[model samples]
Target: MENGILARRRRELITGAVVLAALAVLPLPIADVYTRNLIIITLLFAGLAQAWNILGGYCGQISLGHALYFGAGAYVATLLFVNAGFPPLIGMFVGGAVGGLLALLVGWPCFRLSGHYYAIATVVVGEIGYLLFLNWDYVGGATGVYVPFKGDSWLALQFKTQKLPYHYVTLAFAAAAWFAAWLIEGSRWGFAWRAVRDDVVAARSLGVRVFASKMAAAAISGFFTGLGGAIFAQYVGYIDPESVLGGQFSILIALPAVLGGVGTLWGPVVGAAVLMPVSELSRSYLGGSGRGFDLMLYGALIVVVALARPQGLVSLLGRRRERARAA
Candidate 1:
């Protein structure tokens, strides 16, 4: 039975790898600059979604304040690169460290709260970060900071000629984030996180350090998200308080988690694949026409999904897969 299970798992892994390899490469053939940029942004947000999943999904902590990490990552990397003349690759790690530290600082206090109080604390922490970013002129404040455009320095994280580079780079980050999630899902740490998520008191009774597990989750999540933010800032060639640390940024991060499946490793990627294209299409059709069609569509989609499938897309897909297997 164990051998059979291992064989089945190997088959599943091989199949998934083939599909993802195809998705990553095949899109290049038909990708115009516009489409390439769109997909890159989609992948970037997907990475963020997966990072958020670590704390929010695995740990069962609903944090609307992930924008703090995302924004901090972007700002720190951008500031170091543009102002301090630091290489972006090094800046990325530094930004990630900052984000991880911030996560520890915030999570240490907020994790003590239970249920809605924890949620509220996250929101407050995010708001504080936003306010500071908005007022801090050293990093462009409300106006924003523009990355200096170098001719062709890959080291500077600047690619002037093609969107293909951006696409591949962002895809790499997304793949890494997904791989990390998969590794964590089957590890001892993952089991502990799930235990704490299910019942903190029970987990504590069983000798699980609930706070430490949650903090570890937060740290890992922040690192991935911060790295993604560095890529995002470089792609945009600009970063600002409003664009980097805003509520919209948080929404973009969380929407995939909600749409796809919160707790599963593949949920964010699947969610981004399904939801992002629709959103982009809606914007193209309904945006800037003095109509709220896109907003209406988003609202409708959320309502329908919530009413019909509260467990989310992953759960729905799992049910279908089981039925097919049984048949």
Candidate 2:
């Protein structure tokens, strides 16, 4: 029985690795600017979604405020680079550490609560963070801080005139996040998390330390998001309250995870691959000077998807497959 199970898992791993390798090489013959740009955007959001999944999906701790971590990473890296003359490459680690510490600080209190209480706590945390960054003068107050354009400084994380480098970097992060999720899903920590998620009381009865597990998840989740945020800031060459760190930023991370299928390893990746392109198209067609078209489209889509398939895209597909096999 064990051998059979191991064989099946090995086959699945090989197949997935092959698919990912193909995707990594797909850009070798790239010619279209728009297509390359779209891929980059997809990978960035996908990475964010996977990072959020660590806490929201796997641990059943729904955080609507993950942007707090992302924004912190962006601001820290940009500030260190701009003011302290620290290069962005090294600043990435600093940003991740700050985000992880904040996660532990917040998670300790909030994890004591359950269900909606926990959810609401996340909202409050995000709101306070947004307000604080908006008012802080050292980080540019409400105006924002900008990174000097280094045409080709590898140490500073700037590349000579090309989106390809940024695209690859973002893809690498997305891959790392996915692998991390897989590791967590298979480890003893993952088992404890699932037990606690299903029933905290039962988990506690079985000797699971719920608070410690949640804090661990938060720390890991925040680290990935912060790292992604640092990369995003460098890619954009700017950081502002509204742009890098906002409730909307958190929403973007959560949406893909929810839509794709929370708790599943690859769900966020699939969700982002589907959601972001449609969003970009909506923005291109309808977003402009104060136009609300993209917002309308997104709102409608979320509503329809929620009502029609609350279990998410992955669940819906699985049901169809089961039905077909039954037939």
Candidate 3:
């Protein structure tokens, strides 16, 4: 069993490396700005979903208020850049730290609840955060913060004419998130989280530190989620309560993971790959009709996917692998 586990880990690492290498070159052939931008959004959400999965999937804590952390990261990084003259490269890390810290703080109280109650608490917390940011004049209030164009510099993560750099940047962020999940999936904490997720009573009886596991998961999830938000703020060159901290943003973050097979390694990446394109295409083509046709189309796709693959699209890959091994 030990050797088998080690082999599986090695294989997963090799597979991840190959996939990253392919993604590195995948965008080079596409010159269309819209297509590249779509890819960037997909990559960003892929990372965010994976980050959420660390807590929601493995730890079985379904949080609906992740936008609080997401917006926190965005606001923190933007504030540092605009007010303190800090490079976003540095500010993003600070934002990630704030996100992780905030997650721990939130989890301290909210973790006392379980199941749907915990999820509801997250939504309430997220709403409170949105309201606070919306009224806080220091964070630019509802007017939002416009990230100034400080010339095209990698240090600042600003690119005026090129979209390829953003693509790679998001890709790297997604890769880092995926890699972190991979590490946790193989670690002692990963097993403990899975135990806690599977059954709290059983996990406790078996000596798992359920509360600590949940808190650790929350911190890690919030950290990457915050990092993703900072990347998004920099990418769009703007940040606002509605844009970053809205209720809808939290749903968007969790949907990919839930639809893609919450507990699996490649679920978020696969879900993001499918979900984001369909969403972008619908918005681009149907949004102009002004009747919410784009939203209808997006919802239809989600319904179909949920109905057809309740175990997530990643299950298809798992099925194929099982078949190959059986043969």
Candidate 4:
């Protein structure tokens, strides 16, 4: 059994390396700025989705208001960089720390409730945060803040003429998120989280500190999510409440994990790879019509995927592998 587990771990690591290598070179041949930008956005969301999965998938917290952490990260990093001349490379870590702390704060009360009630509580908390940021003049309020150009320094994480750097940055972030998930999946916390997810009563009876497990998952999830948000704020160079802290943004964060395969490592990446391109393309080509056609198409695709592959697209990969082994 030990040898089998070690062998599987080695295989997973090898597979991850190959995938990362392919992604690293993917944008090299593509000259289209739009295509490269799309890839970056996809990678960013993949990381965010994986982050969400740590709590929502593995821990079964089902939070609908992750935007709070995301927005908090963006605001913290942006504020530090713009006001104090702090480098965003370091500010992002600060943002992530704030995000993790904020998650614990939010989880403290919300975790008392279970199932949909907890989810609803999160949405309320998230909306309250949005409202606060929108009204608070300290963070620029509704006017939003623009990340200034301070030459093309990597310390600032600003690349004026090149999109390639941002691509690599997001790719690294996504890779890091994946690696984190891989580590967590093999940890004792992972086992406890799965037990809690499967049945809270059973988990508690088995002497698992259910609350601690959930809280740990939330902190880790929020940290990575916030880091992703900081990267996004830097990449776009502008952020507002509607852009970062809105309810829709929460849905966007959770959708990939749900569509890919909750509780599975590869699920978020697969879902993001499929969803982001379709969304970008649909919005680009169909959004011009302005009759809500783009949204309609996007909604239809999601519904189709949900109805057709309820277990998520990642399940297809498992089935294929099983068939190959059988052959």
Q: Name the lDDT value of residue 200 in candidate 4.
A: 94
* Residue-pair clashes per candidate: 0, 0, 0, 0
Which lDDT tens digits does candidate 4 get at residues 78-183?
9999999999999998998999999999999899898999999999999999999999999999999999999998999999889999999999999998999999
Off by over 4 Å in 1: 1-12, 325-327
> For residues 136-228, what per-residue lDDT tens digits would candidate 3 score against the true structure?
999999999999999999889999999999999899999999999999999999999999999999999999999999999999999999999
Name the runs in model 4 displaced over 4 angstroms: none
lDDT of 4 at 85: 93
lDDT score, candidate 2, position 305: 77
lDDT of each structure? 0.83, 0.86, 0.94, 0.94
**Clashes in model 4: which pairs?**
none
Whichever of 1 and 3 has more TM-score, that candidate is: 3
Positional deviation of 48 in candidate 4, in angstroms?
Answer: 0.4
Which stretches in model 3 have alpha-carbon errors above 4 Å?
none
Error of 3 at 296 (Å): 1.5
C-alpha lDDT (0 to 100) for residue 148 of candidate 3: 97
TM-score of 4: 0.98
Number of colliding residue pairs in model 4: 0
